[model samples]
Every structure is written in structure tokens, then in C-alpha cells.
Target: MAADRLALALAVTIRHDGNGGVADDLTAPEGLTDWVRELAEPLRDALDAEDFTADTAALDAVRELRAAVRALFARAVRPGPPSSADAHRLLPEDQAMARLNAAAARAPGAPRLEWPDGGAPVVRAARPPGFTDADRLVAALARDAIGFLAGPERERLRACPAPRCVRYFVKDHPRQEWCKPSCGNRARVARHHRRHRTES
Candidate 1:
């Protein structure tokens, strides 16, 4: 679910340009940071992570990651697992994992043992030695994307079938097709019109 959430967040960055065109938020660092931060907030809240500011370098990393996340979701909605070539084209597994690990290495925390009242000691994440807040945010997203692709939830991801919508979403139930009800209605109407045309 978290992965789907992440996928949805990334997908939203690709906006419809009103003339059946698409716009990428990654074109500018400012826009990228805004979009990533908008989504990252939920992600941070989920982890109870401290807020992170996206720098130029962090923007570049997240934009690259966005491509990988997009490609994975696109592949998931297709008939089978993406071919090795296709998968590698967007984000090579080794490369993505390595980047993720690199970002994580810079995460602002070290594992420390914490003792709670009447509770056994538990290891908690503390600020790491030299990582910035942005590193942690980007790392968290990378980890989510990897887990989602590898986990069973990938099976439930779907792309909207609306005429001009390019969003991918998790299917809430069986018999679901389009990403939202409006898309489903549009699909139904299109199918109905096709049947009528054939009959006529």
C-alpha cells in the first residue's frame, strides 16, 4: 500500500497539459522539490521522520528515482513482468539498489538502544553522523519503490484507461478496471457506444 501510495505520488507529477499533452514536474528543481515534498510529507509522517529540505543534488536524485518508479508501475500494468531490457532501461536493479543504499547511508540516524518504561530495550534510529535531511527522504522513497516492485502488491497496481489520463493506482477490489470511477464511467460509455455502433 505504501508503495502504491508512492507510485501514485510520483504519477501525479506527470500532469495533463489540457490539450491532451503531459507535463513533467522534474523539469525544474524548484518544482521537483515542491512535488516531492508534497508527497514526501505523508511518507515522512508514516515513518515519523524529521522534515528534510531538497537541495539541487537531492532534486536530481529524486527526479531520476521518479523515472524508475514510473517505469516500474507502467511495467506492472502490462501482461507480464517487464523484460530484463525493459526493466533495466528505466532503472537497473543493481544501480537502483546501490543508489538507495548510498542515500540510506546518508540517512540522519544511527541505531541506538532505547529503554521505555517497563519495556525491554529497543534499537531506534537516531541522526546519523553526516547525512542531510533530504538524503533520508529520498532514501525512504527509494526503499519503498524497491519493496513495492518486489512485493506481492505489484499485482494489484493498475493504470487508468481513460482517454487522456496517465495515472496508475492500486485496485481496491475485484472487477475494478480504471483508476477512478470517472474513468470507469468513461470506459463504460465508450463500450456502450461501440456496441451501439456495431448494432447500427
Candidate 2:
């Protein structure tokens, strides 16, 4: 489920700023580098080393993949609206799938089995040698997104509808309606204001 978490993390790079606007955490090479480092534990397998640096190309590639992933996420939540920030600009579903698949193919990983002492055997996708850091990062993100879309977690995915909030999150419990507590509070406040306006 690490890959699933990673996929969700990548999708959430586009989020709501506290000031009622959209904010992107991966807007530049430095931002990408910081994000990778912040999620170093989940990204360790995808990166060649702990000090992985990003470049302009890497930033562009990641942004492209993010668009595709968000499109697919919108598809997954059919009958429900996607995040308001980019819902009007989602890529076509087929194009998004193709892009994700192509990115995942960049690294060309093979399945590797490992059996740790006193632990269960595990099978993981192992990237071949000689790929660039950008290739690895993009491939890892795409592969994780593919896995997440195909897995059971896809059923739990929801686009938070809180005012000015644009996020996709897995519903942890049956009653969960927002990505977090603050979002829920914001949503309630918005609803209350709407009701008061209608009455006035």
C-alpha cells in the first residue's frame, strides 16, 4: 500500500491555499526536489539516492503526469464532481491512460522477489540499471497511480467539496465527507452561509 499512498500524495500536490485559492507544490525543480525529500520514506525505492535532485525537465514531466492522474481520478469519481480547481481542464480519459502507461514504461522494471529473515516473501518491481533520476521518479509515480486506480482503494476515492478546497482523498470511514477536519469545518460554514443568504 506504499505505492497507493505515494499515488495519493502525488495527486494531492494540487491543493487549496488557506487564502481561498489553488496552490501547487510542484511548480518548480526546487519544489519537486523538496517534495521528494519530504516523502523520502515512500520515495526511497523510486530514487537512486537520498539526495535526488530535480531539473526543469523533471518538473515539467511531473506536472504533465499530475494532470493525467487527476483526469483519471475524475473518471474514477463519476456521478460526482471532480476537484473544482481543474475540473474544467481535465485531460481526456484515453489520453491520460496512455500518458500514464507511457511514463510507467520509461523505467522498464521487472518483478523481483525478496524474503527477509522471519518475514513473509515480497515481490516488488525492480527498475533496471542506467535510467536517469527523472525517468525513475516519473515512472514510479505513474506506476503507483496505475496501481491505485486498479486497486480497491479506488472505490474510496472522493473529491472534497469544501469551499475553495481541491483535494482527492480516500474515505477512511463511512461518515467521512472531507479530506480533513478543517475542510469539513469549512464546508459546514459554507453551507450555513448559503442557508442564511437564501433566507435573507
For residues 89-188, what per-residue lDDT tens digits would candidate 2 score against the true structure? Answer: 9999999999999999888777789899999998766767899889988998898899999999999999998888899999989999999999999989
Model 1 earns a TM-score of 0.69
Q: What is the C-alpha lDDT of each candidate?
A: 0.63, 0.88
Candidate 1 per-residue lDDT over residues 96-140, each given as its tens digit: 556655654555455677899999997755645465556666666
Give residue 79's lDDT in candidate 2 (0 to 100).
83
What is the model-wide C-alpha lDDT for candidate 2?
A: 0.88
| Minimal lDDT window, size 10, model 2 | 1-10
Sliding window of 10 residues with minimal summed lDDT for model 1: 80-89
- lDDT (0-100) at residue 95 of candidate 1? 64
At residue 59, give the lDDT of candidate 2.
93
